[model samples]
Each structure stands twice: as C-alpha cells, then as structure tokens.
Target: MMQNTALMPGSRWKDPAFWMLAPATLFILLVFVYPFVDGLILSFRPMNGGGALANYITFFTDPHLWKTIGTTMSLALPATLINVGIAVPLAYRLRHKTRYQKIATTIMTIPLTLGTVLIAQGMLSYFGPNGWFSQLVQALHLYDGPVRLTHNYWGVLISLVISGFPFVFLLVLSYITGIDPGLPRAAATLGANPYRQFRHIIFPLLLPGLAMSFCLSFVQAFSVFPSAVLLGSPAGPTRVISIAAYEAAFENYDYSMASAIAMIMGVVQLGVVVVVLGARRLAYRGPVTGGKG
Candidate 1:
C-alpha cells in the first residue's frame, strides 16, 4: 500500500491540505486565541498593583454587581428554552417538503439578516409603550393603557427570541432532515403513534443536535449588550454581564477590572454550556448491538 500522504515524514510538507489549513490556523492564533490569552492575563492584573484575584474578590464581594449573574441567567435560559421549544416542533412539522416551505423559511430567517441593533430599533418603534403593538392591545382593551414591552426585561427577552429562533430552527430542521425518513415511516407502519414514534425513533437521534443548538443560542443570549441597553433597563433588571464589562472598561476606563469581568462572563457561559452538554449524556444514542440489521 502507498504510504499515507498526510503521515509520511518528508513528503507531508508537500501536502496541499497542510498549506490550506495553515492560513486558517495562523488566523485563529492571531485573531482569536491571542486576544483571549491577552485578556486572560490582563484579568489577573489588579487595579492597584495587588494580586490577580483582587478584581475577582471585588466582583464577588459586591452584591449588586454579583446579582447581574442571576439577571443574565434568568434572561438567557428562558430565551434559549423558548427558542428550542418552538424550533423543535416547527422543525418536525417542516421536515417534509411543502409549497410554503421556502417562503416560511425565508420569513423566519429575516431576523438573521438584520443586526441586533436594527431589531432593537424596530422593537422600540413598533413594540414600545406608545407603539403599534401596545396601541393595538390598548385599543382592544387588553390592558388599561399601552402595554410596556420595551426598555425592560421583557424587551430584551423578545429581542433574544426574535434573533435566536431562526438559528435554532435552522439547526434543528437540518438535524431532523438528516434522520432516515424511512425509520419514522417504518415505526408508523408498525402501528406506533406520533408521540411514540418520536420518543422512540426521532428524539434520541435529535438529542445531540438540540443540545448543541441550546448551547449556541444560550451563548448568543448571554452576550446581550445592545438590546439590554436600547430596549431594556441596563441599570436595573436587564443589566447583563456584557454591560458590566462595558461599563468597567469604557465608562470607568479600567482595563484590568474590565478584563476580569470579561473573564467571568466567559466562565459563566462555559459553565452553562458544559452543564447542557453533560445532560446530553443521559440521552439515548442508539442500539448497542453491531449493525446486524
């Protein structure tokens, strides 16, 4: 057999794939990994030349500052759940083709094309207390006055859902389609009901993808800054961790403290992602036996 081109000692250097990957590796090192390491080191530098942990101490010692963790989690988790929940059923229904599929997909994906800032601006104009959504609700006597939807926690929550749903839906739909369509049909032929077919044949295979979608959408929500500022009470209910880092860096001009806050934000996001991925271990993957069927 010919020696493996990728593994051969001297010839490996001539491999086209190695050269193709080199630029991407260098870009990641320079653009992503380097900044991360620099920020991590800066986080250790105390505000007044003390130990690295001093900023961390200040972070945890202050109840008001620390409480932002709870605030951020409250928003991120719910938004993620809502997006995943809606996406799963919608994706399942859309797995098979229909004439309206393309149109529906394009509509749902509109938010992806629009930036968060644009969406925030739209929410302010359309969903604010005196805007169309509120005015319509008031017109129908749904409330005593124009309902408060923006410049608060609810606004940020809505913003996250609008921005995150398409991403989750697209991912889940792709996963759903990847499953052998014949499997579900076979289960149906065997007299399995819709719910049973899903629980036994579909859900297991989709678990990994759903877990990944949840982690990605949660990270997106966790990093909320513009929506929190424009469509939320940044000083109050919706003061997410990104805002804290922003204030520490730009407003206060304290890079060390800012870096520490940034690090904390990353740690919190990582913890949530780990917990979600860990929960995937409990899901059924497939049959244990060899492929005898």
Candidate 2:
C-alpha cells in the first residue's frame, strides 16, 4: 500500500510516457488559473497610484449607487416574471402542438443576434421623436407633445423585455419538452382535469427549472448597459449598476471602484440565485395544488 501510494503521487502529474496528459492540463490552467489570478489583483488596486479607499467608500455612501441597484432590480424582477408568465403556456404549446414552435422560437430569438447596442440604435429610428411610431401618433393626433418612449425608463424596459424573452422561453421550453408526455395523460385518465393535472404534477416538476430561468433572465436585465446608455438617460433616468461600473472604469479612470461595484453586483446576482433556489425548494415542498409559482 505504501509503495502504491508513493508511485501514484509521482505518476499523477508526470508526463505521459505512453502519451495523454499535457494538453488537458495546460488547457485547464490557461483557462481558469491565469484569469483568476489577474482578476483578484485588479479588484483591489486603486484608480490612481495611492490607495485611499475612495472608490469603494464612494459607492457605498452614494445614494445614486443604491438607486441604480434599485432600477436594475425593478426592471429585472418584473421582466423575469413577465417572461415566465408568457413562457409557461408557450412552452407547453410548443411541446404538445409543435405546429410552428421552431418558427415562433426563431422569431423571438432574432433579438439575441442583434445586440443591445444595435437594438438601441434601431429603436431610435423606430420609436424616437422623428421616428415612425412618433409619426403614427402625430397622424392620429394622439397628443400635442412628442411621445417619450425612446429615452426613458419604458424604453430601457422594452429593450430588456425584447432581448430577454427568448432566454426564458427556450429554457422553459426545453424543460417542458423533456417532461414525459404520458404523465399528464395518466393524471387525466384518473379523472384529473387539465388545470388540476398541471397544478398537481407538471408545475411542481418545473419549479427548479423555472427558478433557474428567472435568475438568468433577471441577471440579463440587471446587467443592461448599451440600451440604457443609448436609448435612455443613463445620468438622469435609467442608470443601471453596469452603467455606473463602466463609467467608473472608463470615464473616471477608476478601475478599483469599478471592480468594487462589479463585485457588489456579483454579490447581488449571487444573492438572487440563492433566493430563487431557496424559494424553489420551499415551493416544491408545498401541496402541488394551485399556486401561481
């Protein structure tokens, strides 16, 4: 046993005389090791040479920082809920019907290819003061003033909803497809109604997946930057945490504070993940009867 243990340690990291370990070992260290080391150093360094704890302190004390955090969550949570609300029925229909699920999925998925920056730019042409929607409103004589959808909270919210729907839809749809179609059928055979079968069986099974989707969608909305900057007032109305981080890093040349804010954002995202997982656990334990999920 002693000899075997001695040989195992020597051979574990040894070069393959027979030929296999070098590439995989190098790949892991390169991908995970270097970046982690760099990020840790970057997170602590100040914007300038002398470190006075200015950046981190500034973020913690600023009311704007909290407001941005609130704005991010306000958009993220509601958008995630809305996406989930629409996704459940759509996912169900996709699996059972399959009439044009691919087409519908593709339509919803188009926004993902066009990034937030591109979408923001396009929105200006379609929804801005001199844009088509504005002209339509003017033709209808709806209001004397220009419609304010392009440069406000609504624009940012709309951009997020457009970009984030497919993410929730596809995740839920994949989960729904994996569900045994026969299970719902079995419940129906035993005299369970459609809604009751879904409530008692299908929905419980989906809590974990839906919870995961919510976290992902929430993170996506919360991290919005290009759309908020281009389509809304980052300094005035829709300044999200990500925008604040970018400004810190680039505009003010405050890398340390930017990293600090980023770390804070990471904490919030992690907290959200934990909260969702906890809620899912609690939800799954309940009587799978009738709840909004």
Candidate 3:
C-alpha cells in the first residue's frame, strides 16, 4: 500500500524539488510579475501633471487613439478566422504520415522559419507596385496603372496569414493526430459519409483545440508591430494599438498614456480568450478523453 506521508515541519524547505523551482519562480517574479505590476501602477498616473485618470481619459476621449482598437480588431479578427479555417482542413489532411504530408508540412512551415520583420520586408519588395505581380497585371491590361499592394491593409493581412497560419496548423495538427484513428474508422463502419463522420466525430473533438488556436493566433495578430509598420498603412488604416502605444511613449514622451494603452491591449486579448473558451465549453459536452479506440 502507498503510504501518505505527512511532511515534517521545515521538510518542505529541505525538498530538492522546491530548491529546483526556486530560481525559476524568482526569475518569473522579477521579469514578468514585477514589470507588469509596475506598468499597472504607472498606467494610472498623470502624464503631464493632471488627475490619476488623465491618461485613460485622454485615450478614451481622443478619436485617433481610440480608433486604433477598431483597426486592430479589424485586422486581427479576420486574419485569425482565416488562419484557423485554413489550418483545420490542412491539419486534418496531414494527420496521417505519408510522403505527401511530409512535403506539404515542410512547405507550409517555411513561413515559420522566417521572422515577421523578414516576412514584411519580402512582401514589400515582392508585392510592391513595380514587383513581378504588378508588372504582370499591368502587362495583362488588368489595370491602367500599378496596383497599390504593399504599404496598405492587404499587405498587412497577407503578412499575418503567412506568419500566423503555420502556428495554427501545427497546433491543430497535434490535436488531430492525438485523436484515436479508430474513432473515424468506426464512424465509417457505421455507414457515415465523410461529411457526417467529420461533423459528428472530428469537429466535436477539435473544437476545444480550435478555440485555443484561435485565441493564440488572435493575440499574436493583435500584437503585430513590425509587419504593420513595414507592410501596412500604419499612419492610416492599419495603425494598431501597439503603434499607438509606441507613439505615446517614444514620440509623445507620455509613458503613462503608453502604459494605459498597453494595459488595455492586454485586457482586450484576455477578454477574447475568455469569451472563446467559454463558448467552447458551451459547444462541447463530450467525455473529456477521446476513447482509446
């Protein structure tokens, strides 16, 4: 029989596992927790000698600053949806090991190897007005002049897709491969068509994973900075919350306002995650574990 041994006084401090975790816990307290708390405190302070709520009031009252939330959501939400939608079918196809799957996954993950800054630069050069695509379009008489692609909203959207899709794909692929192979086969034996099999079996199991992937991808997209500046109309349509925060801090020298904006950005991402996870709970009432079969 396994005995439940109660720890003696001071034994917890003597434990090797506790010692092992101490450094990491200390590092987290210093690096993440302390900085977050400091920022939170700074966010409520006055920027230029005003009330405590001055920075927050300015952010909410200023049309240009407040508009950034809508711009960010406009870009992030669509990109997240597209990434998750494309990832689901692609990951489903790649669940099984095959030569084609190997080749496809390798090609799909090529974007993962490239950083967002590098990807933005490539998009600017390759999809710019004088680039091959535009030249071809002009040659084909599709338009009278060079099409504006880069330094616009579309460029940013494409960059988000290129960078975000692989992450969503890898996550969904792991969840898909974790599912028992026999579950789908059983559905097939029960005379279910491919559509029915996926609807009744695959999708239900994938919902929890899909929700997580959506939240992660949305957060990544929401935090986009380099790509938005390089490949998008940052001064106009694609001026995201990050840019606004950067401008408030570095350009305007208003650290308090910047901290407030940063806090709001975190709150927005957290709210979306909570909402999506809550919806996932409502949608799926199945057994926690997929059967061994």
1-293 per-residue lDDT for model 3 (tens digits): 76544466777787898989999999999999999999999999876868888888888899999999999999999999999999999888888988887897788788889889889888777799998889999999999898878888998999999999989998998888888888889989989998997888888888878898999999999999998999988899999999999998999898988999999999999999999999998987768455423
**Residue pairs with backbone atoms closer than 3 Å in model 1 (clashes):** none
What order do you get sorting by lDDT, best first? 3, 1, 2
- For candidate 3, the clash count comes to 0
Residues 101-201, candidate 2, lDDT per residue (tens digit)?
87877887788888788888888889888888888998899977677788888898888877888888999987777766777888899999989987877
Which portions of model 1 show Cα errors greater than 4 Å? 1-9, 288-293
Alpha-carbon error at 178 in model 2, in Å?
0.6
lDDT of 1 by residue, 104-219 (tens): 68888889999899999999999998899988988899899778999888999999999889999998988887888788789899999999988887788888888999999999
Show pairs that collide, candidate 3.
Answer: none
lDDT (0-100) at residue 50 of candidate 1?
Answer: 69
**C-alpha positional error of residue 262 in candidate 1 after TM-score superposition, expressed in Å:** 1.0
- TM-score per prediction, in order, is 0.94, 0.84, 0.94
Model 2, stretches more than 4 Å misplaced?
1-37, 48-54, 141-144, 286-293
